[model samples]
Target: MKKIISIYILLSFSFAYPVTLNELIDLAEKNSPVLKEKALDIKIKEVKKKQIHKKKFGEIHLFGSFNRFEDPRILYPITPPIDPRNLVGAKNQFITGISYSVPIFTGFEIEKNTEISILAKRVKEIEYLLTKNQLIYNIKSIYLKILSLQKQKKALISYKQSLIELYKNIQESVKVGKKPEVDLLKVDYQIESVEAEIEKVKNSIYALKSALKTIIGKKDINLSVIEDVRLTELDNFNRTQLLKNINSLDTLKQATLSEEISEKKVKIAQGKYLPKIYFTASAQRNMGNSEYKDLWQVGFIVEYTFFDFGRRKHEYIQSKLELKKAKLQKKTLRLKIIQKIDEALSEIKTAISKIKASEKQLLFAKEVEKIEKAKYEEGVSDLYDYLLAKSQRFLAESSYYQAIYEKESAISYLQYILEEFKNE
Candidate 1:
């Protein structure tokens, strides 16, 4: 049993060192599955753009055909002064050729499509940044919470020790008949309660560390302990400055790209209403049992859809509506961004106020606990009053820490909304 206890103690301390915040953030970036997926999306958009651009160069084909006719005929068309000898005929015929066909005109559809693909790629890039910003924000928030909980655990441990000392003193008093037996029981109960609270804090810390491990993609990394996080103060911002810079936000940029893509779709629909022109060139060798001929031709083909069952018109209308919808979405996102920034700023102010209030509360609670401790020692106060004062002090300390971390969290959220991680 002693050996088992020794091994347990060794194992517990092995992973007790704190991992730095920057190191964790870097690990998350390097190993995040979601970020990798977004990167692949950008590459796909790039390939799509290339594919559309390649269409402008047209395509070439090598074609062949064989046939056995019912009757003898000329191997291929021949133009002459009706020379019967030269017009040889055969039943078996074969033709092989190379043809090149290119679109001479399609109302600029290829160009518009290429533009849309470029915009889509840009949108993907913006999405990647947005994902990264949110991810970092989440990591920071969790890290701060863990630090806060760790501090609370320390306070709880200290509180428990004080209670234990009081329980011992009360036991001595009860033996001497200087205090009632119930006072000893009361102190013992307070100690038990503090122990329970300490266990609760330990369980919370374990759960948070497990979640942090998943986020960084290093489930095996030792996060059994974490150091306190220090928050860097952010610069002040007013409505005017934030609004002026809102145009550069990634969400808005993605919306703009969507609007542009929709506009291109409308143009593509309009292109369908116009005539299409194609240029074709081919060279072929025609063979028969007794005749061999070589022919080459170059021509232009014009195709116009003079009628459709209002399909083109309906598509054009749909595209227009989609474009309108995208515009409205962009407008909505802009308003949301403004509102979020305002709310974040207000939260920061509220947190600062709480921090100040909690600081004073903690100071007063400490004084009260000190006075109660002295009075209890002098037999002028009851155990209940002393324990209550200590509990109040512990709670005040917890609240102060909570307020500070909340302010930091609010600042992190504001930075995420502004997409400030790009600069980092």
Candidate 2:
């Protein structure tokens, strides 16, 4: 019976429990409408690539036409019949046919188009990954912020409890004519102030959680986020290796794909200077009042536009300019990515220093508060000193939690910049 009850309790906890950062990110990816849209874009690009590929094989069409003439004419070309009655002529005729046209050559236009489509698909895939990475980063940052707030709230509650005890002690001292009634009132005011701050923190937490729900596409606003201390531990990345691996980032990959696509466009434009060749074949039956004739033909066609008022030349130049622009953009993006990496690393270090400083400050504040508490109770100090010490302690505790979470947030951002969340 005890085992069954334990299983039931575990099941209940599994159904509704604090989700870890990774679990939240997974939920956001699975439910986020933005991610869904990006996923659909990938599929659309895939279909587009296939469409461009099929174009190389050409198209087949079924065509029908009707015509009326003022004078009777032969429905189709035929040998003259010996009997005049056997001649097939009509004022109205109908022809129905199926025709196939395939591009034999367009100076590599088809090949270039196929290549562009492939590059486009790759770009879409990278874009999807970029979107997912961004979502994960957002979830991590918000989760850290929420955890920080909760810790601050807990510290505030502790502060309030201490104040309440001090208030009761001062009340008794005032009754015994050892302390002023104003001391009790002062502690009362401080308690009220701390309570207000706690309420503010509560509201802020609610707002952050609401935002989290929106991002994760969840209807439940009562979300409990778990803090994994391991996430705060930084990995020592080789700065040189990180710099060298920047090219593998999704942003750079996207830019590179764009440049390649532009190059393909330039090639396609250059192809326009050459003649286009096609293979055509058709089979048809012409129907008249008295006869029906079947006809079929196969042929190759070559079309050359030697002069188009320099249109092809202008297009080729334009494509070349675009390719140059793409190259410039890629260079700019590379520099920016490097700058961002530097900034994130610097932030991580700064947060680490702050965490250390705040940790020491909190320890000092706790000792000062304890000393002041004893002094105030023994009449060695006044209420003001005790209140100040408690306030300082609360601030130090809040700062410590803030610094810790800030480091976590910075690390999450660095991981995002590095595309570390792509696989997840």
Candidate 3:
């Protein structure tokens, strides 16, 4: 009977739990409109690349026409000897033919332009990943915040329980003339104060949870267990290593590809100054006497745009400038990433120190409370000392959670700058 009851309790606990972080991320990825837009951009660039390739593949034209004119010859009265009206009288005609042109070369611009679309697609993919990374960072921040509130709620409940028990004891003593009635009143007021604080913390937890639900596209997120690490983990952080990590992101990779694409653009632009060569073939059949016939011809055609008033020169210069700009942007981004890493590490250190000091103060306060309780029971201690001890403990616990949450925030910030938590 005992084993069955225990199993039932476990099942109930499982069913009542909130959704996890990974599940929320999965749902967001599936439904996020922003990500969908990025994916479509890739498709669009891919199609453009196909068009660029077709520039090399050549063009094929298949055309047909039919006419039955009522006015066979709208002839102006003219002289004999093949009069101009003879040309007009041949009005009823049918035409059908297939003509094709295959490009043999295009100054190598077709191949070079194709790289531009490829790079554009890559840049779009990187932006999408960066957006998703930002979302995950935000989600984790809220996630840890809810956990912090949970810890706070637990601490407040513990403090409130102790206050209530002490209050009950004082009330009994007052009834028996062993304690002052005013003392009972004082403890009762403290109880009310603690309850108010607990209510405030609860409300904050709800707000944070609500925001988190909107992010992960879900309403039921469980923040019961928040994994918090000590701040000492960042004491030996290497700035060089972190900067290297930032460059490892897909965004940085896209930046490099953009430079390469720009180089290709310059090549394509220079190609404009050269001549493009192509081969050609054409066939035509005409029937005016109700007789079928065929005519065929094949030859090579070369087209060279030899000059364009310095347009190609200006274009090549623009492409080179763009490539330089991309490199500068990459350098600026690296500097910013380095700054973020240093600041986050500093924050982690400060939180750790504060937490340690708070821990010591809490221990001292616990000892003071023990002494004050004994004196109060003997009627030698006043209400002030007791209230002060209780307040000290509450404040200490609150600070402890605050430090924890700050450390969590720092860790998350570092993870984002490093792209550690973001999927490639």
Lowest summed lDDT across 10 adjacent residues in model 3 is found at 71-80
Q: Write the per-residue lDDT of candidate 1 for residues 1-424, one digit (tens) a residue.
A: 9999999999889756778888888988988777788889999999999999999999999999999999997987878677888787889999999999999999879989999999989999989888888778888889988888888999999999988887788788889888899987787888888899999999998998888878777788877666667666663667689789999888898998899899999999999998999999999999999568999999999999988999999999999999999999999999999999999998888888999999999999999999998998888987788889999999999999889898988888888889987545
lDDT scores for all predictions?
Answer: 0.88, 0.88, 0.76
Q: Which segments of model 1 are wrong by more than 4 Å?
A: 1-17, 88-92, 233-236, 288-292
Against the hidden true structure, what lDDT does model 3 obtain? Answer: 0.76
User: In angstroms, what RMSD does candidate 3 have relative to the true structure?
Assistant: 5.7
Q: Candidate 1: TM-score? A: 0.91
164: Cα error in model 2, Å:
1.3
lDDT of 3 by residue, 241-356 (tens): 76666767776687788788878887887777777777777676644435444566688887876677878889889988988898898788667677888898888788778878
- In lDDT terms, how accurate is model 1? 0.88
**lDDT per residue (tens digit) for residues 29-111 in model 2:** 88999999999998998898899899989999999999999998887766645666766898999999999999999989989
lDDT of 1 at 136: 84
Q: Over the full model, what C-alpha lDDT does candidate 2 score relative to the true structure?
A: 0.88
Per-prediction backbone clash count? 0, 0, 0
How well does candidate 2 score on lDDT at residue 396? 97
What's the residue-level lDDT of 342 in candidate 1?
Answer: 95
